[model samples]
Target: MKLSEVISIVDGALITANADLDMDISSACGADLMSDVLTHARSGAVLLTGLTNPQVVRTAEMAEIVAIVFVRGKRPPLETILLAEEKGIPLVTTKSTMFKACGCLFQAGMNSCDV
Candidate 1:
């Protein structure tokens, strides 16, 4: 799936200054634990998480996550946003909960990062 499609499916808005909206996403993973993300998320997957910490951005960078979707309409602090922007990782936010957003993407044919 494409990042644009994920945005449309979850009613998400890009929070980053610039991002490749056309980036191809290999899969999706919804997790709050950064360790879980590091362990299970595949490269090119979009991470659906509620964590708005700068550490989330760092974790994404380490895991090679293509993008991040902050659920429940939560917005990260400016520091987090800046880190994401600096790292060239796109950040998105949605009013939907993590479960709903993940379900929406799954229903739309996006595969899970789970093996």
Candidate 2:
């Protein structure tokens, strides 16, 4: 699915400046643990997480995640946002819980990252 479509499906708002709105998101991974993200998330997947730390951005960079959706309306701090901007990773926030957001994306035909 396209980034724009994923955002729409999850009712997310983009918070980063350098996003490719049309970028293709090959899969989704919902996890709060950075270790799980690094271990299970596939490249080009959009990470749906509740973490608002700068470390989340760093992990996304290392894992080659296309974007991050902060669940439960959680927004990252300025430092985290800046790091994501620096890495060219888009950041989004949604009012849905992690489970709900993941479910919405799954229902919309977005595949989950293979475990």
Candidate 3:
């Protein structure tokens, strides 16, 4: 699915400038634990999480995640945003809970990375 489609599916707002909204995301993984993300996430996947810290961006970078969706209306700090921008990762935010955000994406034909 495209990043634009994911944003529409979860009713999210893109917070990053110069993001390629047309980028295709092949999989997704929702986790608050950076360890779990590193363990299970796939390259070019979208990470949905409630954690809003620089570590999240760093973990996404290491895991090759294409984008991040901060759930429950959470917003990352400026430092985190800057890091993500530098890494060329798109950042989105939604009011949905982690489960709902994941479900929304899944229902829209986005498979879990583990699948």
Candidate 4:
């Protein structure tokens, strides 16, 4: 689904990017642990997390994840945004809790980021 559709699905706000709405996502993974993200996440997936640190950006970069949806109204620090900006990753925020956000996405036909 398009990023715009995802935002609409979860009532998310575009934080760092006016990303292209045509972006297609095949899967998703929600986690606060960067290690799990590193080990489990795959390409063309959106990451959902409450963590707001630069490490999140780094993990996304390494995992080649280009989009992030922050759960529970969490927002990353400016430093994290700076890194994400440099990496060209999209960041979005939502008021919904992690569970609800993931569920909404899943119901919308988004799959797990893990293989």
Residue-wise C-alpha lDDT for candidate 3, range 1-115, written one tens digit per residue: 9999999999999998999989999999999999999998999999999999999999999999999999999988999999999999999999999999999888888988874
Query: TM-score for all predictions?
Result: 0.98, 0.98, 0.97, 0.94
- CA RMSD, predictions in order: 0.6, 0.7, 0.8, 1.1
- Give the per-residue lDDT digits (tens) of candidate 4, residues 9-64: 99999888556777877789999999999998988788999999999999999998
Give model 4's clash tally: 1
* Candidate lDDT (C-alpha), each: 0.95, 0.95, 0.94, 0.88
lDDT for position 74 in model 1: 100
Candidate 4's TM-score reads: 0.94
Between candidates 3 and 4, the TM-score winner? 3
**Candidate 2's residue-wise lDDT over 1-115, tens digit each?**
8999999999999999968999999999999999999999999999999999999999999999989999999989999999999999999999999999999999999998997
Best first by TM-score, ranked: 1, 2, 3, 4
Model 3, residue 49: displacement in angstroms?
A: 0.3
